[model samples]
Target chain A: DARVTQTPRHKVTEMGQEVTMRCQPILGHNTVFWYRQTMMQGLELLAYFRNRAPLDDSGMPKDRFSAEMPDATLATLKIQPSEPRDSAVYFCASGPDRGTSPLHFGNGTRLTVT
Target chain B: QQQVKQSPQSLIVQKGGISIINCAYENTAFDYFPWYQQFPGKGPALLIAIRPDVSEKKEGRFTISFNKSAKQFSLHIMDSQPGDSATYFCAASGWAGGTSYGKLTFGQGTILTVHP
Candidate 1:
């Protein structure tokens, strides 16, 4: 099946540790997005990229959080010095730049900071 | 501000019963509305979607009811099965800032439990 793929499906780390989550968007898809899902806050968009260029990241914390698409098929979200409050499921989704295409998401990486 | 508001944080239904979730939006510019279903340990999947231009759309047992004037929409799962139990999120997307790239704003999801 053609779907977005994520790595490190689950992770557990102590506070102040660095965490990295990766995603592989479906081939030929031009737009990628990173989102954080939490029970209290619901789903929120962290960053969006088009053609490997970040169009908006206002929702992501600038100091410790960064999202990048090093190549067409790869996208990554990194957190340095993670905190317990940052524990949540991080999802990656991809879609076509044009048309009314709905996003196809990866299984997501569940991160727990203790 | 929360762009969209969802009702009934959760719902419990018996098998062969109908399940419904409602959502309302504040932005009239939102043209694309979609509902996503997520199971535990999985990412949300697109279940059904509707545009403001259409009042209602149905695909098999899933139906999307839209009310353009109220800026509200709802999803109805007919004859819900145990497998239908999941968390459902309603999302809206539209172009902004002179760019065609659309950003989705999601609602606080509703959890549904179907009892067999």
Candidate 2:
């Protein structure tokens, strides 16, 4: 069974520290999405990439958050000078860009910023 | 701008009973709706989905009821089981112009607990 893999399943960092989360999408998937899950906000789309190129990142905070897919297999989300409010579970999902393909998600990376 | 709204932030049902979750969307442009089931520490998995063209879709004990005119949809699980207890989310997507075809807008989510 193919699945999206995410690293650093759990991360704890002090405020102002930099946090990086990594995801390896399914081998043949062309679309990658990054979402943040919080109790107050539910799940919010942070960014997405199609064919190794970013299609949107409007939901992300440009001043501190960034998402990049350097290659098809690797996608990363980074937060510089992370704040306490950044604590949440970040999920990475991937699927085919065409039709109504369903997204396969990683287990998620839980970040706790103090 | 909460495009999608889901009711019953939490629900409790006895085993062998029916569990229903309702969701409404404000965007008429949304053409696809899907439900996801998530367990603690795990990612949300696609359970079932329906398109605006269809009024209902079912797979096994799970079913999706869609109302295009009302902009509402619901998930019904027959014979609820304890293993089914988890967080459920309703999501919608549609053609929002350039490269926005599959971008999902999720609901607030409902936590369901099944008691024996």
In terms of DockQ, which candidate is strongest?
Answer: 2
TM-score for the second chain in candidate 2?
0.95
Write down the lDDT of every candidate, Cα atoms only.
0.91, 0.93
Report the C-alpha lDDT of model 1 over B1-116, residue by residue, as the tens digit: 43899987999999999999999999877888999999998899999999888999999999999999988999999999999999999999877554433378999999999999
Q: For candidate 2, lDDT tens digit of each residue in B1-116? A: 43899988999999999999999999887888999999999999999999898999999999999999989999999999999999999999887675654589999999999999
What TM-score, over all chains together, does every model reach? 0.96, 0.98
Per-residue accuracy of model 1 over A8-101 as CA lDDT, tens digit each: 9999999999999999998999999999999888999999899999988999989999999999989999999799999999999998878568
Q: Could you tell me how far off, in angstroms, the CA of residue B96 lies in candidate 2 after the best superposition?
A: 2.7
Global CA lDDT computed for model 2? 0.93
Model 1, runs deviating above 4 Å: B98-102
State the TM-score for model 2.
0.98
